[model samples]
Target: MSDAPTTTESNPYLRDPDVQLMLRAKAGDDAAFSELVANYQSRLVSILSNLVYSQETAEDLAQDVFMRIYRSKNGYQPTAKFSTWMFRIANNLASNARRSAGRRKEVQMAGGDSSGVQTGNAGEYLVKEKSALMPARQLDKSEMQGIVLSAMEGLNERQKMAVLLHKFEDMSYADIAETMELTVPAVKSLLTRARENLRTQLESYFK
Candidate 1:
């Protein structure tokens, strides 16, 4: 789907082909389930990897996501877009894993291409790079990634997840709210606070 924002006249969720494919899977089409898994595997792993911070764990969690979906196919419903539903499941699973493990120490973000980076196209990086107060030496990609990832780690889990869904997925506020089990206003508030926290944390990089 085009990431471009379009009019809501057409309910994008209902219009998504993946939703139809999921419905087919719900109807006991094993091949449809395989196709759904194929279509989402990489994307799911990418998103989960950032959340969980381990490609190996992300792959395992993604497999678990598919397993859950497959097991509950009989009760599948289309209340939201297939991707949103899938991601909601992913978010919950990640949150549970984090909570279960307890007190995770902060780690530097690594791995993944720019496309999978949750920070969004280099907009924030450009702003920092062009700042008058920036150090004379240009920040390389690794430095930028470190700074961005550090700032992201400063956010609360919900704030971080909200930023990820908003920036990486290009999801509408409504869709994000649906995926995160939040109200539209709550999503907006979460993002506002998240951006403020990031800006504060990254202040040294800016003017």
Candidate 2:
């Protein structure tokens, strides 16, 4: 009659559907593995594209992420949301790529899209406070998108990653902290500074 909760009871992420799919993947279910890939491929590519600033590079990195996941399937653990685990891999890969490259450069978006990512709700999030940033005049969608992309570029790598996870993934601060391997408070501070930096950059465009 112990009152303590079991591991599964304690970790609610274990109940996530993606985690169940991954568990099946770990059990050598080929279809399950494919399903996981299908589920996350676009999201992975989109996030990676923004991180690396190149569509081609993003695609390659995304493939690498899947490969890594496949190879590590036997050891898969449901410690967090599957997306959080996946993005942790992505964040590391992007950081390593940047370190090896040793320079930042602008790359054109695929299909003329600003920010070079799927950017789910990110544009909307950016303009939620539009009045403050563009007091002089109203910007059309294209113009606002370009400014948002530029503002995103102003952030450092960590801040950009945090913001992307927050806005695009709609991840909680706790999940983001785990994905980024930072404390919760640190993630909060990082996101706060990221928003401030973005606001400053966007305001400069109107000024």
Candidate 3:
């Protein structure tokens, strides 16, 4: 009943993974670079979409990320994980975009709720929030989504980035700290507070 092509959860580069590919790519293996792009393109786009709305802008930024990677291949070291490095660049680009522009409004199919992600309705129930969020009312799927995004939007720049990377990008505290140029404990504390704040804001609706 669907026309979409089936996608497999395969990454051929996993044998050598991203870092190895980058090394070969630096040695002028065009195929290796292409493989790296194929491996990470989806993740890059998904991460960017969480921050920006325009697909065009996301594509441009994604290309720039890769370009920087290629340019820096000679000096690159695997001190941090490949993903951490990739997202560090992504976070920088995203932060700069936010500073230069206003909020981007677009429906995101990534990171809001998937794979144990909280839902607006609990266990297949359709609950609707009262008009204007009247006290003690329920929240539907869209309302819940809006509430999460809005609550996240209100966080200070660093907190927002912390939440986005931790909760959505699934980065570790160490990786996040490295990306944001913060201490590990600081990243942990920030995420703990961000989660608590979001939970407090959405508790009534969630239950």
Residue 164 accuracy (lDDT) in model 3: 74
Model 3: worst 10 consecutive residues (lDDT sum): 117-126
lDDT of candidate 1 over 53-89, digit per residue (tens): 5566678889989999888887765566888889999
- Highest-TM-score candidate: 2
TM-score of each: 0.73, 0.76, 0.67
lDDT string, candidate 2, 1-207, tens digits: 113232677978667899889889888898998998999999988787677656567788889889999998887767767888899999998888776554322333223323323222335534443544565455676476757776787789899999999988999999999999999999999999999988887877778
Query: TM-score-based ranking, best first?
Result: 2, 1, 3
- lDDT for each residue of candidate 3 in 13-64, tens digit (9 for 90 to 100): 2333676787688688989989989988887875565455444466777898
Stretches of candidate 3 off by over 4 Å are: 1-16, 102-143
- Residue 20: error of model 3 in Å? 0.6
Off by over 4 Å in 2: 1-7, 103-140, 204-207
| True-structure lDDT of candidate 2 | 0.77
